[model samples]
Target: MRSWCVLVPTAEGELVRRFLRDRGLLQKHLAIQREADRLVIPTVSRVEIGLPAEEREFDEAFAPIRSYRDVIRIPDRVRPLLPTSFDVIGDIAVLKIPDELAEWRDEIGRAILAWNTKLRVVAQDHGVAGEHRIRRIEVIAGEDRTTTVHVEFGLRYQVDVARAYFSPRLGTERMRVAERVRPGETVADPFAGVGPYAILIGRRRRPRRVIASDANPVAVEFLRANVAANRADLVDPREGDAREVLGEIRPVDRVILDLPHSAMDFLPEAVAALAPEGFVHVYGILEAADRTATTVEIQRIVEGEGRRLRHLLVRNVRSYSPTQHHVAFDLRVGRA
Candidate 1:
């Protein structure tokens, strides 16, 4: 049958498939056809996923419905409220069920599992909490365990979703920062969650060392395991408060601050650890209307610590809310 398909190279099949699957765009009923070095993946919706779609012939397979909405036994009036997509962390699916759909969570969970054969667990995320920034997840269907291994850019990371925070959404952003590291330069990631940024930078670039620190012991434990799993010898995992950890490892050539909500609060610690003309990659959640003032305040923060902002680049990473954005500030600072 002729269907909308994304022709992805064999090397990039897994990445693109996961991307399409997470967004509920992948058509699961059709058998993907292999042509030369590319795999043609069928998609249900026309989403701009940086790849062009073309009509291709796929073997029609007797498979279950591809979307949870298709199998969910809910009334037509409340069908619109069913979540269209969920986060897939490894084989685990993290979904947020609204109060209106709370009664049918089990049915929804089962439906979601049926949609994806690779998913071994389906968890309900009740928001992140506490100093460690852990998600309060409850297993709705499949396996009861929260531990899983997530892969990004061909590197493996052991992640306990309930005990630690790891956002697969930042995979591209992590690689972006990693590609910026200069050889022989020491990088410090103060808010390293499971060593994503630090390990990525260590593997991608020949940094002298990548110091990864986190207050959460579970996250740091996984970071250590991930560093070893990937054989990222340059990445050193440390368990402690970022301020204290940064103090112990002084004079870093670059620093990564990933705590979006409270990253600015630790700006002084990051500045204190930087070498002359050192770089700092800080993330924050900023109001769209206050972008100008926020940039000015960032400059002020850098200057307040007796360091002049030699160069600054602002990037809006993603949308946090209707009026707020997750932003990144790339800063190079020198002596005042």
Candidate 2:
């Protein structure tokens, strides 16, 4: 049984693997082969593999596979009900399975494990709830574990998925906010869950100080662990309500409010904690068509705090639901 493959120089094997993984084109069942200093990588399709400058296809006689869909081995009856995608965090794969697929949860979990050898746990997201916005997940395959060490942007974060709210999807956003921090500036990440924002800022930007706080004690514990794991010497992890913590850390150069659902409720405290002409990054969940209303509400909140919004940059971070969006507003505020 021969299979088609993409040929490239052995030196470019890692690059090709990353490219395939990023594009979701990697063929997990076919093992990579070596021939005369070149690597042959099995791919899902032969058309437009998006080869880099250093890679090229090698001519070989092989039978082409039917489709990548066959690799998962889902029954035709249940195939349409399968989730299109899932999140891989460290050694765990978190899936969002619909109730219709409830009977095949275990099968779906096992298939996810087979899809990625690095994954040791397969969990299904039951949705986020409560004040901390923590997700409830059920382990359907492999080891029953919720704690995992995830690495992003050269920083390591230990997260207990059940106890803390952490999302790998926000990795880029974290770096984006960190890159905006100027050296020697004091930052306040009032809702710094697991220290993603605080640790990234302290490690990459080397901010003078980062006051990271969370209301959930379990999350705070992970935050402290992550701070030390990443050797973020400038980060100060605290366990308390964000409003109270911000009050104690008044006059910070930058303030990050990441409690998307309730961040607006703490606008006054964030404004009070900001230094003169400071920058504030606020994340909120809003209806897709309510961008104007969100802006007006934020502007009103700042004005009520006796601050004028000097500059405002609004961005849609991601889609929270079919009708809602995860939006971010970067506001540069000063005395009115």
Candidate 3:
């Protein structure tokens, strides 16, 4: 069937498209078609009579609806509150819906399914809670299972989101740390969860040995499974407190502490476990304004252990919240 659309010169297509999209006038399900020197974009409303010169009314004939916005059927008043994106792990879709849109969770899940037929589950995130830092998720659609194997950088990780802590967002950060690892050097990930960091380092850098430890037994189980799945033989999966684990495997060439909220509490153990001239990759959550103070504090911690910081590099891994960031400090320490 034919429908009303906005026609614009090909040169001004993107501008007009953006204008329509910003105003929620663009019909996402219909594919943009081109004829002669003009582009035809379908719209839900035919109220473009007073629009700018680039956009003019036209009849769009026989264009199939390939994709549509998730909130197409939702009331205009509530559409703006919907989240535009979500995280996907394996066949599961994890969404962080706002409280205002809580009632439409099922509709949102169905919309996600419409966007990707491969996704088998849609789970709502209630944030990470408790000492394990496990995500509290409520399955709103599809399968009820929470366990899945996520593949990143050609490595596979088996994680149960409800039982273990894992973030697909950290894939690049994991690779960055792995790239810094040198072959023939032993590495330790004291707070390793599901072996994402340790397995990646072992598989990519081929380190001499990687000791991966996690206090959460469920995480340790998945870590061991991931090691076997990825055939990361160099990683030794251990289940225990990071401080105790590091104390047992002391003097490693590199140590990775990824517990952002409380990684500093284990700094003493990290310093004690570092071999001479070894590096420690410490992850923390800090405000942008407090970066300098945090760096100084870390330096003081190292110095308190009678060790000198030979070289230190800090980077903003990601934003933890509007006011805070997930930061990493790569420090090369040695005897004072």
Q: What is the TM-score of each candidate against the true structure?
A: 0.80, 0.80, 0.84
Summarize candidate 1's per-residue lDDT along 157-196 as a digit string, tens digits.
Answer: 9999999999888898998889999999999998898998
Give the candidate order by descending lDDT. 1, 3, 2
lDDT of 2 by residue, 111-199 (tens): 76766667899998999999888999889999989999999987888988888989898888988898999989999998988999999
Query: After superposing candidate 3, which stretches have Cα over 4 Å from the reference?
Result: 2-72
Better-scoring candidate (TM-score), 2 or 3:
3
Better model by lDDT: candidate 1 vs candidate 3: 1
Instruction: Assess the local accuracy of residue 80 in candidate 3 as a C-alpha lDDT between 0 and 100.
Output: 81
Q: What TM-score does prediction 3 earn? A: 0.84
Model 3, residue 98: C-alpha shift (Å): 1.1
Where is the poorest 10-residue window by lDDT in model 1? 63-72
Worst 10 residues of 2 by lDDT: 52-61
Better of 1 and 2 by TM-score: 1
What lDDT does the true structure give each of the candidates? 0.89, 0.84, 0.85
- Native RMSD of candidate 1 (Å): 11.2
TM-score of 2: 0.80
Predicted candidate 2: what Cα RMSD to the true structure?
9.4
